[model samples]
Target: MIIDGHSYCFPPLGEANGFPTVQEHLRYLQREMADHHQPVWRLRDWAVGDNSLLAEPQDKTLQGLKEVNFRSGGYGRFVWTVEGEEYAKQYLPPYLTDLSHPPEMLIAQMDYIGIDRAVLHAHPIFGFLNDYLADCVQRYPNRLFALASIPEWKIEHDSQGIVNEIQRAYSKGLNGLQFSVHNRYRYSVTESWDAPACRPFWDGVTALGKPIFFTICAPCPGSTVEDYLSQLRIWQGWLTRYPNVSAVLTHGFPWRLFLSDHGLHLPDALFEPFRTSSAKLQLLFQISLGNVWDYPYTQLHPTIVQLVETLGSDRLMWGTDMPNVERFCNYRQNLETFRTHCQGVISDQDINNIIGGTAAQLFNLGDSQ
Candidate 1:
């Protein structure tokens, strides 16, 4: 029942720069789980790649650049593969094992590892919604859930289209929608997401009465802590305005803001805003990066613990922005580290909520299961 909220799958090897093929990636995952002596059922990966249809700025080169920016940093490299030559060694064995590959090899890996449920997000720009999810759910009824990625940009001005997409996905038995507030098209106009243009979409989602997995990427325009703090305030304001929105702040807001630099410490101001916000919003702050547990940054654990104390476990969830940033973190280890440090600060019930229940409840997966 340990639900991993954020995870990813790469494009087929021939399609992308990261792993060579989906099968290779899955095998590596299986081997990694075995090495750690972990059960697969405890894990759930949210496959992110293969978003060809949602590609905006129609120009292929621009799209490629966007993909590289989002997925090709130092963190991205490590997630798809290990630090150095070890990644090649780790993947080569699996690559040679089998030539036949399923389109959902990523999903297969989850199954092989004993993962009871998996939630998937179809890339928004690319129209290729995950058709595989239905089959996976049919095949492993209790273990698979799909979260449709609505093309907010295309439908941003078209409220009806947005509602149509939501209804379409729901009709397919999909659980929820992965709404991106940071992509160029969605939240570009104004910092306030509760504006009139977006009200209809929000109303539709709220009417669905299902939990929507909302993500707001911190605007990392500069290298200073001030830049990170500024973005944190924007998000805090967002949560404050939409108290009914159940949102999860992924990519460790301030951490990713300063990730390019070597500094691991977060500014005190980031958590300061949330102290006064309402708790009904169900905000789930994640420690996605693995290295957060090491040195100087260990101080962040206490602050995060305090956030949980104030926000409650029902509002917290564990996530690893996999395939997007590799670094020292991934799925299994990140959760283990989070659990290790959060023991006394958070209760077992809260831990369970953070691990899976919260996400499940937020995303409305309970009834689907």
Candidate 2:
């Protein structure tokens, strides 16, 4: 069975999407960017090719901004206009603009791509979707496993409320929790997940016996390799504290940042967390580094081989940050990048383990299958 381990399904990015209004959402975006010390207001366009959604030549005006409007197009491109001059734009699958990504649409894409199952993820931009995710899994019990997301900003002020949501989500059939450390830095005062303020939240999730998908990253833009390593050290501490809790390092390590003039310079200390049996790492290359490389991703093959060698294939799992990746490559390429492209370097047995076996065992997906 094939599983696309990391994917997002969310409402449209407007009033009905999550925030009270489009302006409110934009304000939230601006605040988030400013907090991270990034340029405010202008959203960076990461989409490329014939379908690039960034602002064009005619959109140079930036003086009087009385009205700001975010309009979604039928062709999967959305534009943010400041009084008539388009300032920012982004791309989503046309289906997503129509009504966001429902489970049925994702399932149809999976069926077309020969994917047997998928693991659903949540994010702050998607709003409170624990209940929504639970309902999706309930509708397609055997096909999807969803992880719950709580507002990290609320963790400090409302610990019990956060714990209640975890218990509530698990009771409703959600599989685990997707906790992003970068987002915590962007939204809250505390930087570390193992901080005293975060202790209650950690204790609550640990009590549920659910896996924690830790989305670790640099504290801010232009961070160094040491900054990335420091975050991993905190994660290592968490693993030591909760030895029985299963932890998956979502997006794996930040690969592009670690590369230098010589080659990939991953310090041995980065692998220290995996010393515990409870840790697993998700392999998400094509989508994560799509802007830097093209389809088939030959540049990343060596990196993939090294991960399998260092961590052992049994501890690695394959993931496609799909829907979002549709702008980069199709779902099929994401899977084949692992299944077919890695044929010479990775043995078939190891490939099987990375593609599905590891996730199946970690999530106990075999019982449902």
Candidate 3:
């Protein structure tokens, strides 16, 4: 069966934002800006309101940037506003204004794209969505599976709370965990999960016996290949220690970070983590480098061949970032990039595993039917 290995579902703007509070959310976003060099800003000159890619580009007032607010432009857009003037904005799907990207919305997109099932991810920007996602999965048991989110920042301080939430979310039928390595910055000193303090969190995850979907990338823009390689080493160490824990590298490897005028320069050392039996990688190029490359992404075909040859076809799974990727290409196009475009570079047999066979086996979707 065809399955989207990655996607997101959340509530409406009012219900979604204001996790701990608007001020804290702003601080977290600021930390993200400082920690990572977001390349999407380069997509369009945010100055002078040039969000032409959006269906309805709104006015951008950058002069008086005072506070960030949600529910702007009728509740679908996240805007940087001060006294009612929007300075900058992040546009979500317009349909989200009704009540966020519910299961129905994603299922409709999946059906239109001819996807049989999908796995959902919980994003911090959308606040904690374990309960919401549990309901979504409950509503569409055969069609969806979701991961639980934890406040990584609190793990060092509130380890019990973090573990409790994991157990609770798991008992409620949430499938696995979505752990963002970058979110650890919310805590003053950033450390890898292998750190002593994070032991309990990992132990809890181990007890549940579910896979972890990881968002691992360079911590900042100025980070070198070694810096990225260091993160992979940490992952390799974790997999070595917890041999039973299945791990998935969300969005695949950071190909964009390694790409330059010299073209994609991925070092052989980078694929070491996937050498672990329990590790898998998600190929969602459409969301990560869609702005930098076009549909069919012929440029990535060679990389795909290399990954298959090096990591083995069974270690790779296909995923679409879903609704968020709409700005770059529609849902159908996202699937076709791997399914149809990379035909010769990737054998039809390997393509079958990359698209659906692997995901179904990894996520245990076979029994869901």
If ranked by TM-score, best first, what sequence of candidates would result? 3, 2, 1
Sort the predicted structures by lDDT, highest score first: 2, 3, 1
Return model 3's CA RMSD, one decimal: 5.4
lDDT of 1 by residue, 1-369 (tens): 756566544333223212245433333232222222111120024322322221332322222222111211121121222222112112211231222223265456555443445555444322235444444445655655666666455454887777876787677777766766544323244434555667777777767755566555533222366655555576676667666655555544545454433434455576665566533222223333333445223445565665566667776766644333233443344555556666766677876777678667765566445
Judging by TM-score, tell me the better candidate of 1 and 2. Answer: 2
lDDT of 3 by residue, 1-369 (tens): 788899888766444253766555544443332332222232134545423322222211121122344233434444444344454344454555643687898998888778998999876766787888999999998889999998876777788788888889988889999998766644544677569888877877787888888888665445678888999899898888888888889988887777866457678898888766569889988776777888877888778888899888888889887777775778888889888988878899899888888888887656345
Model 3 per-residue lDDT at 39: 23
TM per model? 0.60, 0.85, 0.86
Worst 10-residue lDDT window for candidate 3 reads: 55-64
- The window of 10 residues in a row where model 1 has the poorest summed lDDT is 34-43
> Who is ahead in lDDT, 1 or 2?
2
**After superposing candidate 1, which stretches have Cα over 4 Å from the reference?**
9-115, 122-139, 185-193, 220-242, 258-288, 291-300, 322-330, 340-346, 363-369
For candidate 2, lDDT tens digit of each residue in 64-121?
1223444454444445554444543344545565537778888999999898888998
CA error at residue 277 for candidate 3, angstroms? 4.0
Better of 2 and 3 by TM-score: 3
lDDT of each: 0.47, 0.73, 0.72
